[model samples]
Target: MNCDLNIYCDESTHLPNDNQPFMVLGAIVCPVNKTSEANSRLRELRIKHGLPAYFEIKWNKISPAKVDFYLDVVDYFFDDDDLEFRTVVAGKEFLDHDHFDQTHDDWYYKMMFLLIRNVVPSPGQAFIYLDKKDTRGGEKVRKLHEVIANSIYDFDRRSIRRLQIVESHHVALLQLSDLLLGGVNYANRGLNSSSAKRRVLNRMQERAGITLTKSTLLSETKFNIFCWQPRGNRP
Candidate 1:
């Protein structure tokens, strides 16, 4: 484990009964040394847009008023060579947890593993950070660390170094993850309510060169996505 990487993870519409049709798990992968640079550049972009340096970028906040700023953010992400995004989009309608004898949380952790497995490099170390969602944040972190470490056979916890919860508002990379994840979830749900959101999604599709509703090749590294299906579900 010579090189180091940082993974900022986030999710959208993951609740069991949130009336949403899809759940999205997303992450931003950056080399440990490039984290600071990326954060600084994002802040600079905020200032360039006449917003405060501490302004938190979020998907829900996207509107016609600030569409250009958000568009610039999308362009910055695709232009940067040091940053990469990956997500797992799963339809909740296809879920049958009882048939598999697994709780929703168990399935979520399993998806977390699948989401990061392709990005975790061999002969390197990774530190994971998930957005703070609720009071069970600590428990989720512990379970996620255990599952990821065990799946990688990192009993000694050397390769998978640290897993913790962080506030998305305070972490630029985590905020970026939320924005990208929200866009993917919005696309998969086949909704076109907001023109601003539609523009953002269109920009992502143009840059990634794949329909947001479909899965990309496993080897695609820059803007990778996996559309997960249940055991008996058809594509």
Candidate 2:
């Protein structure tokens, strides 16, 4: 069997009119055989924190009371050798849907490609999990799956086996994506309302040895950041 990669994806401030400075798409990648171990480790984190077995890990739920628990989760991600994350941040300041002759939806799919560039191994199949973001229909999601598969030149769509919408609460790795992506979005936008959130950001800086305020090096493997800006304008 081809050893596949499982990618748990989540996004922050994705709405076209949300008025946020950046739209962040982040993913957690793990080898096929290691998925269960990753899930178990995250579940253990919840138990370590006294959270209920059913507790749903989330970025927006971080607070003073739960800050330490969240920090430990962050640390686990950094310490785990089998896990990896990458993010692409697109600024909305000078974006024009009309200029690209694309609907906001179309632009989103394109950005998704950039977010995973070089992250997917072509020789191995990839399974992508996205948080349930819309109920309009499944057709959009289906189209996105096709687009990605095609971009990878997987015309038969075999290399990329699946791209499905899932509830974040049930998926530990997806929730991790939410937390890490939230910290990136918060730090980039200069929002520091929570000390715990700031702590995660600072910790990431200390580990990555790069400021989170800008794009990371193209070759950064553990936590890669890609900043997307308008061609003629400063981001």
RMSD for each of the candidates? 1.6, 2.0
Q: Which digits, one per residue and each the tens of the lDDT, describe model 1 over residues 84-194? A: 999999878878898899999999999999998877767899999999998999899889889988888989989888889999999999999999998999889998999
Off by over 4 Å in 1: 233-235
lDDT by residue (1-235, candidate 2, tens digit) is 2358898888999898898988999988889899899888888888888998667778788888888888888889999988889998888778888876888888888888888656777678888888898894387678788788888788897887878899888888888899889888888888878786777778777876778668878878789889998666444
Candidate models: Cα lDDT each: 0.91, 0.83
In candidate 2, which residue pairs get closer than 3 Å at backbone N, Cα or C atoms, i.e. clash? none
Clashing pairs in 1: none
Specify the highest-lDDT model's number.
Answer: 1
Model 1 lDDT, full chain set: 0.91
Evaluated at residue 101, the lDDT of candidate 2 is: 80
- The TM-scores, one per candidate, come to 0.97, 0.94
